[model samples]
Target: MKGLYCRADAADAQPKFVIQETSLPEVLGSHQVRVQVKACGLSPLDFKVPKSVVDGCYQFKLSDKKIENRIAYWCEYKYEWLSVCLYVRPKPEKLSSVCVAAALRDALCAYTALHTHARMAVGHTLLVMDGASSFGLMCIQLASYHGVRVLTTSHSLQKHTFLEQLRPSVARVIQVYNGSSDLLPIVLEETGGLGVDIIIDSGVRLQEEEELKETKCLPHKHELISALGVGGHWVTSHQDLQLDPPDCRLLHLKSASVSFLNPETWTASSAQQGRYLHILKDILEKMAAGVLRPQPEDAVSLYEATVAMETVQHNQRKKAVVQL
Candidate 1:
């Protein structure tokens, strides 16, 4: 029944012991199952929780006694009648950590693009910016799995070659320097000047004083904005992009839509949570049956208990369990 707890020190500080061993609370009704967590993945946000809570900057707090044993996962109940549960495989201690992080990144990108940004119709084209990251590459694979044509970009020629091997569904791959504005013309030409159906901006944008310099030097932002067709969508995970409006007025001019994913708002709804669990069950069952092969035998691990948190910060990912 031992569980993980965030320490109030460095971002990557390891989990510490809670005052009490973690355990499932008594089941309130038939709708719930005490899931034993098999594996939980660490996210960037997971590393940030310690500082926020310890600094007294965090808005949410539980009695030292309550959170001493529990931290809330994304699943939660809205109305008293509803509840949610998610099942995930744990990462193994020895495998490449990037692979598991990539899996979650794929899940997030796939879910976000499929459900949030552009509806994935059978033949639609998806343009993924920064296509080399685990999230971007996974987005390409998932979009292709659903029959969407994917166009992705990478600054690394070598990485582009690697991605091409990974995603046969990618219709085209473009190589450019980071923040290169010159590539926009090439992108527009390749797409027949009509523009792409969707643009995913996953690259890092310069900020503060550096950002001002980038504005003068980089044309990727401008080119990206220009390349969206009317009614097409642009999506980004950039925090500054989320907080402030894009510099260009083209979205308003072209009636295009822009969306920012604040992973903080990523909690599943009651019904959606049910669906998520069902999907995970199917994934696990497939792996068990050897129908859907796992990347490797030691790809992930499973955990035994749940931890509760009052309010997790905006962008970190943490590992936890669903005790069944």
Candidate 2:
């Protein structure tokens, strides 16, 4: 058996990725399936894992658990664990880790919107922040497929123009400038004075070092809490809300719920994970059947691996794969 390892050699480090040879331990359970990893998707958090900010931002303890322990959690519960070891990389160009990420994003958006947010009801409106990217576009398509209206926002004018050309499921496109003004009014107007049933804020701003330590009133935090509908939900993979703004009564007042979609949460054995996996498998099948398309693969390589050191750093929006 073979695997990838994160190495530490100051001069040799180009980026925090590595590939290596290793032997697999004997299988200890009948339920475990030894998957030959063909490819795996690299996320921004993967690059940030080595940084000090990750220690405070993410949910899992990198130093406390083994890779196998984390994998077992995901296998048992089907929660999306970001801290997963790549066991096998599938063959062929069409089936790769990037495809898996796209599938997962599609599934997450679909499930969160239809089942969790809107309860899969027809005619519900979905407002997606930063809707031009891969995840946002998938959310639009999935929501539209279920007869739901979608409204999205983008920071880039060029990207917005390009998205406009695509003629996606979007009912309206708004370009947000200053954070002071209320964008909700425009969103409500687009929905005929009825506010959106759901609002997905993917670009959540985190606290600055000084503010994180001292401030009680953060502008971005307040805006987010105020943006939600009477019973809206905010989902993010970046920061843990429980630790931030503990005094903010928004969670109790407007029925606002904040959930962190970290890798650890994905490792839970709850029925939700099964539902997510089912949705993901279905999306992958759709892609395999040529019913869906994704962004082109631009692969990046991992140079080496080492224990005790962080594995990824400064990850931009790119698809990275390790050759084992």
Candidate 3:
């Protein structure tokens, strides 16, 4: 199998990727299937992080000659034959394969975070940080579909404007400019000082309260807790996030709860596997019905995957997919 391999070097911070040949697995689990790669999705998590992961969706052919279309996440390779667990679900015939590859996981993340973790309902107020990204956009659309009022934040004014004009309309689009303190204030103001019912954040500032003029500067933990209304749900992707005593006190005061949005848990635990496949099916059906749509794909060949991955890490593209 030929794959885009990432070799980490201690001398440099960035990992270098190259196409390399690796041996296929000799054995497969009873429930596992070997899939031929069709397209692989690239996001900040795949590129910015040092780990090598092919976050992909594909059309497959098993040993028994049975056919399936699957969206998979596996480490250490970009594309090739993959032995994936039963995370398989039927891809909607109406949706393009590249679209599924580019958006499936992110859409699943949004769905699980909002519906499962947050318990989002119609008329609920939602605050989605990093609202311009594919995941963010999906969160907005899904929430809006259920009649929730959405207040989203974008890194730039241009994206903020675009989000404001979205159909069904966004409640507000707050622009965070180079560490500007805009999110909390705007969220509070729009919600009439009550704050939002749900907050979905990609990442948060762990230690530093000091502002940095970086483009992708994350919100401070303090700000996140402060913007939660009473009994609010705060869903975060910040796995390493730590909360201070003050942060805890604020959440306590508001009777707010927090949940980590780790989609991989479904695959890691046996009990949730059935639910995982069900959700995958629902997401595909929604896309077919026009209730859900993926982010625009910047398609690249296998040869150009390395450069495309770099571009994703730098936030130069919304979403990138390796099309085979």
User: Model 2: per-residue lDDT, tens digit, 1-324?
Assistant: 554443333434553434556765574344334444433444332322342322222222233222221111122111122233222112223655545543444445555655654463577777777777666766677677778778877656776785676565677777753333356577667766646666666655455333332122222544555556666666654454444545257657777676554443333323344554555556666556544555554444344322212322442333343432
Model 3 bad stretches (over 4 Å): 7-16, 22-34, 43-63, 68-86, 178-180, 207-209, 215-217, 310-319
Segments of candidate 2 deviating more than 4 angstroms: 7-16, 24-34, 44-98, 101-106, 109-114, 117-120, 177-182, 206-219, 242-253, 270-273, 288-292, 301-315, 318-324
Candidate 1: where are CA atoms >4 Å away? 8-34, 46-105, 178-181, 204-219, 242-248, 263-324
Error of 1 at 270 (Å): 4.0
Output the better candidate (2/3) by lDDT: 3
Q: Please, what is the whole-model Cα lDDT of each candidate in the order they appear? A: 0.51, 0.51, 0.76
Least lDDT summed over 10 consecutive residues: which range in candidate 1?
A: 62-71
In the range 1-324, model 1's lDDT, one tens digit per residue, is 665553345334544423346776664344443433333444433332222222321122222231121112443222223233333343333333333332543455456655566766786667887676656765775677668778877656677786677546677777755544455676677678878777776644444334453243333455667788777777776555522355446777778776776443343333344555444444333333433221321223223221223111322322222222
| Candidate number of the best TM-score | 3
Reference-based TM-score of each model: 0.60, 0.64, 0.81
Q: Candidate 1's error at 47, in angstroms?
A: 10
Model 3: per-residue lDDT, tens digit, 1-324? 788766554534566667887886667766455677788887654323322222343323445334566555442222233323444467777777799888887888999999999999988999999788789988988998999999888777777677777845577877776455777888888989999999999788776645554424578888889999999999998878888888898999999999998775554334665677778888888898988867677679999988887777666765688999
- Candidate 3: worst 10 consecutive residues by lDDT? 46-55
